[model samples]
Target: MSNTVFCRKYQKELEALPFPPLPGKQGQEIQATVSKPAWEAWQALQTRLINEKHLNMLDPESRAYLMEQMQRFLDNQETDQAEGYVPPTQA
Candidate 1:
């Protein structure tokens, strides 16, 4: 049996992550409220942000920016988009 959560992003009950995606209280909160699908979406977006923006993970500022974006994304708040982003067209 899988754990279920009332996903804030999807606004419905969905499959939960096996563990928190991050460390600390925020990670625990996300583990409790976010769904696996939503977390995966965030991961995709984070990858785009890193690639498109040429973010350096070694830089604390870059990491902070990503963290802020992640929180906003999970909260369904407005988040920064990758520069020169073009949406892939459906085939």
Candidate 2:
């Protein structure tokens, strides 16, 4: 299997905040409890996965896989935001 390197460290300060899930149009609220460092890492990883062309140049299968991964990352962020998880600001 290939290796993955995500440049992010864990931060506890963000975790201690009271992040109550916001109410949505569907009637109920969604809760998310992600640490600041993990959130930053996830965002960076998503950007790398979406912008990096190296994986696409490797092979058709690799390209397809990367695209799928990118889509999932986007969906996850949307869902998380809808559920009320404020993403960490980019540094």
Scored by TM-score, the top model is 1
How do the residues 1-91 of candidate 1 rate in per-residue lDDT, one tens digit apiece?
A: 8989999999999999999988999899999999999999999999999999999999999999999999999899999988888899999
Inter-residue clash pairs, candidate 1: none
Model 1 / residue 41 / CA error / Å: 0.7
RMSD of each: 1.2, 14.9
Off by over 4 Å in 1: none
Pairs in steric clash, model 2: none
How do all models score by TM-score?
Answer: 0.91, 0.30
